[model samples]
Target chain A: MSTTISPKNAVQVEASAEVKAVHQQMLRQQRLNRAATYAVAILLVLWILVPIYLIASMAFTTPAAVRAYPKGVLPFIPFSFETMNFFLQSEGIIPGVINSIIVAIITLVLSTLIAAPAGYATSRFLFPGRDFYRLSVLAVRAFPIVVLSIPLAVVFINLGMYDSVYSLALMHTALALPTTILVIGSVFASIPFELEEAAQVFGCTPFEAFRHVVLPLVLPGIAAAAVFTFVMSWNEVFAASILTVQNRTLPAQVLAVLGQSSEPYQFAGAFFMMIPALIFIFFIRRYLFNMWGQVSK
Target chain B: MNEEKQSTQKKRKKINWAPYWLILPSLIYLALFFIWPMFRGLGLAVYNDEAALSLQTEPSRDAATAGTLPQGTQVEILDQQGNLIPPDEAGQANVITEVWYQISAEDADGNTVEGWVSESRIRVREENEAGAPTAGSVRTRIGAGDTLTEVYSEPNENAEVAGQLEARAEVAITDQSILEIWYQVRGEDRNQTVEGWAQSRYIQVFGETNTGRIDRGNTGQFTTEYLSKMVNDRFFWPATITTFLLMILIIPVQFVLAIVMALVIQARLKGNSLFLYVFTIPLGISELAVGILWFSIFTQSGFLNSFLQTTGLINTPITFLSADTRYWIIIAIWLAEVWRATSIVMVIVVSGLQAISDEVLEAAELFGASLWQRVRHVILPMLKPSLQVALILRTILALQVFAVVIALSGGDVVTVLANETYRQYSEFRNANVAAAYAGLILLISMGSAVIYLRMIRSQEEMAA
Candidate 1:
């Protein structure tokens, strides 16, 4: 009886030990997986951030450092704004910036104003041709700006608006409108119809319900859409380059002379073009998903 | 109760016109700006603003002008002279010998006139007054001989050999003539019908249409000159090839990276929010900035060289952006595009992943599926719709890639479709050709969009 019991206990101990070893191995594998994931995450982060950091450094570096061989990877070893200042002082830079700002603002305002009503109509009302309108907007949104700009330039020249800020603004508005409408439509759609009905139930008219109840809630989304529109206009080089000559936007101005420009100017100009849009993007980061979410759907 | 019924009836009878009113302004604005410009843009491909070419009185540049020959004018070339147009500053003159023809044709005002016009300004075609090949105009056949006649691709003698027409080979005359010697013909070659230019003397000639009329001027109305010009431009194919190359190289990598990024965020690990923000930082960065950033990396003495040298990886900084290393330039542009544009795809994937319920993934896990299996069988299947949308968006945007190519390589070493359009419009001062490029891009965009839709829909049907 003692021999049989001892052998069984021995077998049990061996089985338990094997199970413990397997559990430990699985844990190790999980840890390695986690480590790999972190490594990948970090690598990706660095991949994006490094290039930006290098450019920003070049933008802030002295002209000499910018032109130096085997340039520094880290930022601001001897930080200087001489290159940036030189770019700013360069001919046409100031006017170019001003034009870009003005065109962006006009585009933002005009596109938002035009799109908001359409956005509301699509979201709130079950109107005839609603599907048609939405699809058309989607189609137009994807229309090549390169194609649109050439003919628009001709029309503008015929209308005597070519090479002017307003013509570009109009083109930008056309570009921004479809996106604005789609984005704002999604923004309006996200709000419950019951809220507007509640306002009406409390003795408000349809317009009053929209203006007071829906408008306040949708403002942030519209602002997000407006920011997107502004960024679009600011970064649009093709149409701006084609449409304007003397009153060139910042991108157009930079691109026109980019071939001949030195290293310092190119880096500084790139940084300058990037900063405002980045700031605007940061302000609207919370709404990034909100803007693109429905557009994709 | 009767009053309530009447009011309800009134509400039902009155149509809701408010939505139409709301959408009207945008619709009209789109019509005027979006729709109108699109039609006009496409129209610019075919319509020529320059209606007529002045018929010079003689072959000399200083010769007095005869009445204008409207574009598309059919003229009888009674005489001909070759003139040498001097080369420009770039020494890239129109290398084809300039042949001027003395011809009689109706002027712009419909009055018959005799004039000499530059051959470059006209298309040559055989007269077809009877609207049929006419009597004795049997299909032209190669003259009987032991030797085969050489068919040229272009009407010019110096053009490449397209094919050889066998002796006694029956050919259809296409009514097109050029260089006063070559006739456009379609004939059977190696059992394949080939269209090419054959020397007129090598083929049997027939009909009073024997003397082909020269198209001295383009009919300014509905011309294909711009479209042809856009296609024939030296930069056109390179731009097209580069654009497609970047698209093909960048897209799959983007989708894969984007999926990984989405998964990383979805992992909900530590600092996931920070990862999300960092991954998306490039979203707001303009393409021009992205180009410059990559240029700084790939440029000689830039960060890449600095890192390589510091690590003792290389003895000298490589010239990555030069014309000789055009492949590197393309890689640089591809990297820039992947870096800057992947954020959008990542966001879309993240949103797609969000729409997918965790229950499906958990079920797969419960079924003992591994992580790879779970992703392949569960997550990816559910992510198709979102992936389709993202693909369409990325494809259209990829076709329009411009500023990045310009910034990285000055657009001279490597060109893309959008860059060529700009060059044609601005530098060459030809809006029509630019418009032609634009029209091509638009067509490609629409075609890809349709293809994506069709492909996904078919897949869905198969599943259903």
Candidate 2:
């Protein structure tokens, strides 16, 4: 323990040296781990981004060069505007976009309209049959979605709303409703009843209190649920294809003609569908845990 | 006191009606669209129809003139007429042959009658409308081969059978030649989709007229035969096994990758949030797009082949989609699904990692634990719920895999349950079979979920 340089202190010096060696070894181990981490991180990042870049590359690659991408990792092949231009000019793109937008918006609206009140009920009320209702909502998922589409096609045709956007919206609502109710229920439950009570006590009606005090607080939950519902509706294809003939959502149309389309058109259509979804997810990255994580728990 | 108690009890009797009012619309919507359709899909299964694939018109006999039923016909399949054709005879026919289903349907006379149909006779009723109406299909290799056929380029016998049309080869008769003496027949020559001319006399021609060719009395499609057809399809089992294998293969890879990823990102390294963002961007992409993205890379002239060729790894562009290249096709599908879906695992695992309290790890480290030990013991144990959820969810998603297989292989070399479901309901026009597939997939998903629930318990909760 002594710092004095004496012959008797040689053992102390060796012990200190040994301690330094161990510390250095630990540092070296840490450095190796850090390097491994970075290597893996970079590798994973590439794994995620390369395909996206390839899809984007297809978007810009000319028809002649469309299938001409350099192998393994793509070499910087010259970009081509032909495929995207053809897809954009082909009369189907704008209508598909519009139809998809209409469907998603309607789905969002219906899901929220139905979800908000039920979520509020689940949060605020200990009413009769509440557990049964929630359980049944969960049970709706017992049927895989594609199973419903063919039969729903019959039901919708019988209803004479078979090919309409509203018909698709209704089906999408059915798909999205359970999640919406469950999530919004969680959201509303998280918000204290005291604020709404305060608002009511201050002479506001229940609806008005909800509009002012609760909704503002409920916005984040609504936003999370709405983003999920939007993505779900936008990404859905099986039912969309089954329900529509002349009018199909973008994914549905792309799937219907996927095999027959030229390489460029297929890539372009695929990339085009990706834009909204990517953007939506980007907007909701913070809520990734909220949307999927809590649902599982 | 009694009056006050009665008043309180009376107030309790006025139940809250708002909850019922709130869920009513959604419940009705689910009832109409979800539940009802599901039941109808079940009804489609085992439905009886005169126009079902392989259904026969006569109960049993050698010369009963069995007519085939259209596939996906939902009528009362009331009874199975015993062995309309002998099983051995059906086997000889090279299709599923077993007991014929008795279908009740309206006859051309609009009377309710029971007729029998065999399975193989009713393929998708081929349309009589050909692009070239003047052309026809030639029956090849019939008994005792009427006349030795000669294919000529000019549809003239003098031109000769320079081209050989092998027995059992399906060749379509080309347009009627001059004076109709020589009819041009086009079919596959050794290696190509080829066209050549043959004397019409040598081959029997069915004109593209409304009176189409005959439906051969193929074997009956019993349930066993039907399942066998589905199983025997080249793509069916592979697609199914790949779907399963992908589910199995990707999980460990994903779990390891996800854990490592979660650890790296959680390390608070420089710009780690950026790393997370880049990783999760794919979470937004649809299954179909991810497929197309990889597809653009795996096609014959796609990125992978191009790279292989450019680098002088190979002289010719490999047909990655060929049926002969089943393993490569599966690899391409696996690559797409893994690249696309691992991010989901990463997201879930990262959250689970974040949930691991710092103190637990600090304590483990104090006990001289290494990073590997800590992960093996602490982190993985804590991640069970997430792992369970992820496994159950991803495996189910894998079972439901549809567009990805289609996008990668264009369903040329692989077929999964989702593909079958769609094909059954839409292309095959059989809602019942599709429903059966749907039900099967559901059963598998539920089974996995139950397994996950049983296997993976949250250790943190237990510790608490």
Candidate 3:
């Protein structure tokens, strides 16, 4: 085709040159699109980093330095852990942190335990009321914990279980359960049923097949669900506040004492509360897309 | 063949109920915790009244003969049964009783009069002197201005001009003050009857004229002052409402920002992988930490004003924590929330985004489409299913927003649904109204879910 075009008359060769120019213009536009993408990337990074920088600086500053008006951009004085120590020594901080960890763990375990098999059932079984079950889970997911927590508080009081960590865990489980079910259901659905059927052919029971074949295949998805549930439970405050008073969670304790203290103590408390979540998020960053995709769909 | 068919039918009857068993715990938990409490709370809001528990009443015959209650009465105590004993008097027989009863009466025009009726005036029905029915009736003394205040009246020209003519006219005079008489005359030439201070010399007394008298005490005016007093008495109750308003202000803003971030990330732009990681970092940060972070920047002597001053943007450092600057603190918290929560949305959206087949995009690209055209026509439509889920989840979470706001604002400028519930359970020690607010939140969440379902259905139809 190139040889044929080369031997063409002068007027026809001019037409081919015009086509080449159009192709060059398309190339230029593609290059411009790439530049625009980079610009967006840069802007997004800056948008995310600025607040983080502010928080880090505040967490590190000394009490006097933090209180000083017109604080220098950099920590002008040497950073100290005095604020953090103050928070650690404050009333309810240690217990609150411990309670938060315990509640989150229990919530993670219970939600995963209940939601996994149910999620699997939802994905695999062609049962009656399947759609209803899915819709009901969605409805539960939509029910505000604030509204639910108030009534739950009363009920707990009546049952003589108010202000207990167990109640907090229960409420947290309720909050995280819907997402767990949905994510695991989607994860299970993505894995072929044929694998389970093949296990059945090897003389395994239905339960055994699921335990070996389906569970192993969906482990990544389950881990993602666990992480999501943990973060949710960790971050939760309203229900925790309403549910527990003496045994407050970390967020609740911090919140209860917010703005009541010196700037350094407040910053230190905030910084400490955020650390676990940040570390957890970093480790599980890759699964975020998968987890979100499953939940959203 | 018949046996084989029968055995197959028998085997089919043994269906697995394990799924039902699996969901049983959650179902039981919901039924006991959510559904039951909801109905109970609703009952309290609609039916129960703490004030009504103290009210007591006794049976009576004629409305007028029932008691000696006068108009415009104010007393601290109602009828005390113990105070009804007769005093020693009247020819060695106890005739005077000391019963104290709160009596309220209203005239035909609906103006209420209320006062304490003495036990002596309240005569119990007894057999007549000759076995006929008999009951005691008290004649109330008219005071100054005690007559019906003339709301409206018609004038009689002949009566005003000293003509001795009978005219159908309405006259109202109170026992307290007959000096000010209100008269409405109905005649051929009727006009408004004016109210004036009548001279005592012009008055004529008649025995039967007061026969239709209404036994009433002075009814207090329902003034703005009284209403305000009532509200003050129940000030703790309204705190729930304030808390709800605060929650509404903070939660939805965070939710919107979060959803937007999620959607943008899910758009599958280049370098979103790194962005997703960055966004998730705030999830690890505690609400207190997020608050402190923003506080560091905005406090009077913090980073923000310092930066501005160093850059010569301001003449002096500004105080950000003052009462006046607290509103800006709320905005800073909002930014913190956006930073913290957008990752959640991003995660949800990205997952949803991935579920969309690449083939769909390929098909659109093959059809000679621009990137915008592909996103508008191909991606968004496919994203609807996920968007609905995201919206429902985000809204529920948003309604319960507390920690971030509390941490950031130190519970000063920010109040929310969750915060109000906390205040009720903690500060005021009133669980009932707090539960009521919680119930309101539940209603909102359920309503949103219903709307979401309707939206998703319509979107589905549109897609189809």
Q: Report lDDT (Cα) of residue B106, candidate 3.
A: 47
Each candidate's number of clashing pairs is: 5, 25, 43
Best by DockQ: 1
DockQ preference between candidates 1 and 2, better one? 1
TM-score of 3: 0.69
Tell me the tens digit of each residue's lDDT in model 3 across A1-297.
877667577668898899789779878986887677666656666777776766556667577766776666666255777666777888898898899999999999998988887887888887778888887776666666666776677778868899999888988887788778888888888899999999999999988998988888889878977987898788777678778878999888877666567677777776676776767787778766665665554
In model 3 chain A, where is the ten-residue run with the lowest total lDDT? A69-78
- Rate residue B58 of model 3 by lDDT: 31
Q: Flag clash pairs in model 1.
A: B71-B218, B71-B219, B72-B218, B72-B219, B123-B215
lDDT of 3 by residue, B215-287 (tens): 1212222223322332353433444454444445655665455545554565567777777777677655655
**lDDT score, candidate 2, position A261:** 88
Q: In candidate 2, how many Å is residue B296 off?
A: 1.2
Model 3 residue-pair collision total: 43
Error of model 2, residue B183, in angstroms = 44
TM, chain A, every candidate: 0.90, 0.84, 0.90
* Model 1 agreement with the true structure over B239-317: per-residue lDDT tens digits: 9999889999999999999999998888787988788888888888788878888988898978888889888899998
TM-score of the second chain, each candidate in turn, equals: 0.64, 0.57, 0.53
Error of 1 at A197 (Å): 1.5
DockQ for candidate 1: 0.50
